[model samples]
Target: MTSSSFLLIGFIVYNLAFLMFVIAILGRKWAQDNPIEHTRKWGNYAIGATIIGLAGHAGFFFTRWYEAGHIPTSNMYEFMTFLGMMIIVAFIVVYFIYRAPVLGVFAVPIGIIIIGYASVFPKDVQPLIPALQSYWLKIHVTTAAFGEAFFAVGFAAGLMYLLRCVNFDSKEKGDRKEQRGVEVTIFSLVMIIAFVISIFGFNASGYHARFANDVLYTGKDGVEQTIKQNVDYVLPPIFKPFEGEQVEMKPFLGMTEAPFEAPSWMKGSNAGRKLNTVVWSIAGGLILYGLLRLIARKPLGAAISPLLKGIDLEDIDEISYRAIAIGYPIFTLGALIFAMIWAAEAWGRFWGWDPKEVWALIVFLYYAAYLHLRFSKGWQGKRSAWLAVIGFMVVMFTLVGVNLVIAGLHSYSGA
Candidate 1:
């Protein structure tokens, strides 16, 4: 089968599995009269479908690798695709340990979401740059992805723990309106949906916001980049910066003589484009959240909690910690060690403290602290779970944000 065909099949299978898990979550009461047993069976059914999806994903992976004559882990599309698969791998491992049915409900959807997010980025399989044309490419990227996948699972478990345990009752904290875990869950969904929407909208409309002024800024490679004013891009700048060239320009509405000026430090590409993306995301997210709230007539977290009521919180906590513990060493070896070694060969230096490297260190240290606190200071349960959640956030920021910002030595992503 063609690689595209394989990927299409994989997408369908995973979405099917995701649907089944959702059904299993919501239909537990109607399944077999016993809630726990029925959901477990439903979760298993989802897993069965997930296994089939995984096979298709593997087919897609190998086919792409063969067609490209290299490991398919270079670009955002490739790495994110592999990362989705890793989440499934981590799910299988955790399931084997605790046999938690709730995990399938959470994990399968996560895989689907990840793969879906990956589809938004550029999908071309370009030839590797000189720096990435090494055997270390396979080792570093693959291992780092695997480690991050485990961390993703830990995030899932940690989130589930909070969703299951936290009371949904409203409480005021100081002068601000305090939100519950379920509310936060909705916010997260909004953000994800927003991101997807922004991606699609920008790509589909080919909308480009015009910059008001030409500006000179340094790129990640430390080269001065001249962004001429009155250029069109997808994003708009959030705030105007005083730096850069201030050339006179006509406004879109013929309102001003000078073009808009924004600092390059704000984002990777055009500041106006980045800003446009964020605005689109926020607008899209808020709309989706409002619809969900209207349809469910309750906070999403509150709605999901009952489905997970019978799940053992202790099991969730344990599995989350185990995932991090196992993943930490692997992440350390691959993302840091292998990464540094590869950097040394490529740039003739070990570490340059690039944005990517800094974020990598941040991810590693966050998890390291999590372990230290969990083991030495006895911070498990809620505390450890929160740490896992934050650690995964750091991992994600490194994954998506770094690539988007075009930071560090990982310029191969754009290649």
Candidate 2:
């Protein structure tokens, strides 16, 4: 099969595994089977399906790498898919160690969501830009992404622990505070789902909006000059580019123009377009979250927490900590040490304080502090789980937010 076919197969089987995992958890009360036997049977089936799916995912990676004549981690699309593959690898490791079928209930969905998110970006194989043409590209990027994959699994386990332990029915102040935090965590995930849905929905409808902004730059002769650049938006234009005018906009909701201009301080590459996408994602997320809340008649976290009945809280808490602990050293090696080596080779500097570089340091330092707190202050259970969840958010911002919202030496990767 072709690389695309391999990807399709992986996607299909992953969904199958997710269904099987759900059955493993929720089907224990069915008719005559012992609960343990029921879980074991279906969990084995789910794990078997997961292994097959992972093979297809790996096939897609190697085949695409051969076709492109370079590693497939250079751009957002390829990197996200690679990250999804590594998530499965990490999950498999943890599943075998814990023997917890319910882990699949949380982990598989994260892999599916990440793969779906990867589908939102362009998939064409492009020639490497000069800076990315080094052997370190494969070493540094793959190692770092593999480490981040463990963090994704850690986020899943951590979130699961929160859902399992938090008292959804309590009115105590501390319990209510934890409940709200869990609710917000669920909402943030919904926003990511909204972003993927909004992109696919708009692009499928061939929706298009364009704006032209005048950019001032220093010319070859060192004279100030201005040029107009076109910015395109697939979603409805909620805000125009900074000091930009409409080039074309399909009328929608009886509106022919954007109602606001991007703020002057928001001046990154395609900042207004990115801002508009963010607005759409948040609005769509609110609508989705509101509809779910109405249907469930409770906080979404509260609605879902019942699924974890009889689960071992300490087991999941340990899983969360172990996953983060395993990832920490790999992340240090790939994200900081190897990254600095590659940067120095390509740019003649170990560190230039570029936005990406700065954020990478921030991520490294944050996790270092996590380890410190865990070891020195005996921070465990809820506090440690919270740190794992928040640290993954930091990793994502370094991976995604910096790329989309900031222009620097690493801007090409965002493309």
Candidate 3:
């Protein structure tokens, strides 16, 4: 009925699609007869569910856009949700092109994780700031997100290629290196999931903490003034703001206050809280990884490599390359060309070395290099797949890290 309802339906349906995809890919071994036919049947069910889920996701977007009287890409929650939706769109397109149900097995879960991560942000619709009040908001942000969505698909395929090909049991140096890289990637993903889980877990228990810090700011009168800024934390404070006073804190595990202060170099509005989140995510990820290792009694890669047994490594490698190839030009247009045009209109400058802008350039150049090496240098297979995976990380940092960690003209989007 409502946008939120539509989003919930989308989330649930996406999860169903993921499950169906898992069954489609993994069911072949368990099929009573005609494994190919079994996979085809379940794969069809998964794709159908995927389409239904996309409809719901689109419903959420359009309904929210109608309710807000603006495109729903102005803030963290809306943008992340839209990004997740676009990822689904990209996945669907790739699915139809390759007819690879296995792609769904990895890609759908990424969309789910993105939406789940998005839920951590505040969702209340708010009026756009002057900077975001432009037609380019619709064109630039959505295009950028859509391009990044394809990159997300590429990451999924690249990861699948690694898991499908890497020798998890071998003791050779190169094999071990690939194995560790996969493990680290898995650990990073676990950290993201862990952070989402921790946020929800603490929020459910009504955990809250606040710290007040005196920050020096330049006044309009060309004078410096000290202002007291308050930072809130939903998770426990492992590192308090530098020279901050405790406003309010809830004791947890006999910990009454943060054990350390954030480094002086960290100087954003919520740098300390962000740092603490990073720390917590790492700790939580290590714990989760350990639990998983204990259960499987081996590296996580080794455990996952089996599901990909019958998969052709070359096909997924092509999927990875093609996805990146298609996404690169879109990303260039949206993230670079359109972005610069918008920036010039909004701030009267075509290029500013704001952290966000710099990172956007970095993303553009990184992918540009990826394409050059892919087409010119004959870097395919493991090399190209690794590039695709790492390229998405660059895209993510530009989208997320620049917003949250680095204070700049684009910082308003973080709010």
Candidate 4:
């Protein structure tokens, strides 16, 4: 099937799986009260459906890459698709390690949201720009994106664990409190995710507007003659012609022409930037709400079921630590080492303090601090959770904010 067709099919399947997850969660109380034999059966079915949908999504991405003759991550649409795939892979790995499909209920929706965000960008197969014509582009971006995806799952689980921990003492209490707790947690999580996604959307849209305006007013000419004309018209006193007769002027007399035109590779960067602005704004609002709720000590209804109550916080913490342990070295190699090599090859400089690079360093440093806290001070529990939370923020900066806010040599890779 065509990639578009596959993508559509994948979207439908993913939505179906998402619905099943919601049903499974909503029916948790009924299953618990009724002692249904089919609970596990239905859960398995939902998981199978999710896996199938993920396969379809992977197929769609591979098809796109095959058609494009390179990685399909050179634009907003491609990056989002890749992110979705990475999230699923991470989810599967985590599920296998921890045997917790509950996390999937949180993670799959995030993948769906990423795919939905991708739909905002045009899906045309465009050629890679000169800046992206490097082997490291693939390695650096793919690995970093992979790390980000795993961290996203980590974030979801961490958030849930935090809520679960603060609200309940034991799994029994959590189970008893499941109904209200689950609903409240899900609601809060959704709100937070929505707010973050919306800000990105807004930022992307804003940048798109700015880029479009710049391109339109600049025209195809190398001269800023349009700007000069505006200056002449609006500020005649300052930009007045020399005190002489109206003589025919050279065509390129005004404005310092660029040695080269802006690369065609840059076409999507501004748009992505604008979208990120929107996403961040939305995220900011949700964060504010979450913080306020925390401060107010709002009592959300108990949502944990007896069976699902009281996660071994230590277990969850260990899972988070393992994820970082695996992800950190990979992230460092790809985002720092390989990225630097790519920069030197492409831009004649290894380090430019570009926003993307700065953010990568931030991610590395955050994790370094995490390790320091964990090992040096033997920190755990709340401190470790806080560190994990901070690590996710750094991951977000590396994944989304870096690409959107920073202008640099790697701009062509949609970052």
Best by lDDT: 3
Task: Assess every candidate by TM-score.
Answer: 0.83, 0.95, 0.96, 0.70
Ten-residue segment with the worst summed lDDT in candidate 4? 229-238
| Higher-TM-score candidate of 2 and 4 | 2
lDDT, model 4, position 363: 85
Candidate 3 lDDT, tens digit per residue, 138-247?
99988889899999999999999999889888999999999999998888788888889999999999999999988889988999998999989999999998888999
Q: Quote the positional error of residue 186 for candidate 3 in Å.
A: 0.8
Off by over 4 Å in 3: 216-226
Per-residue CA lDDT of model 4 for 1-415, tens digit only, reads 8787777787788778767765665566677765344444555676788788878888898899899999888887798888877877787777678765566666787777777667655678989888788888689888877877777676666655665555443456545454354444445445545554554554454421111122224456665432221111110011122221222222222422111222334343253333434444455556665665576464342333333452567777776776677677877887888888988898899899887788789888888888788888998775676567657766755655556555565565443
Any runs in candidate 2 off by more than 4 Å, and if so which? Answer: 216-226
lDDT of 2 by residue, 1-415 (tens): 7788899899899999999999998998682558899999999999999999999999999999998999999988899899999999999999999989998998888888888888877788989999999999999998998888888888999899889888999999999999999998888888878888888988888889999888888888999988888888888898889888888998888989999888888866488877786788789899889988999999999999998986898898889888888888898899889999999999999989999889988888988898899899999888888888888888878877887677788877653
- Badly placed stretches (over 4 Å) of model 4 are 21-28, 33-40, 167-310, 413-415
Q: Report the number of clashing residue pairs per model.
A: 11, 0, 0, 42
lDDT of 3: 0.89
Candidate 4 RMSD to the correct structure:
10.8
lDDT of 1 by residue, 296-385 (tens): 898777776667776789999998999888899999999999999999999998999888898999999889899999999999887787
Residue 41's C-alpha lDDT in candidate 2? 92
**Reference-based lDDT, residue 119, model 1:** 79
Number of backbone clashes in candidate 2: 0
Q: Which sections of candidate 1 miss by over 4 Å?
A: 32-37, 170-186, 201-261, 264-272
Model 1 TM-score?
Answer: 0.83
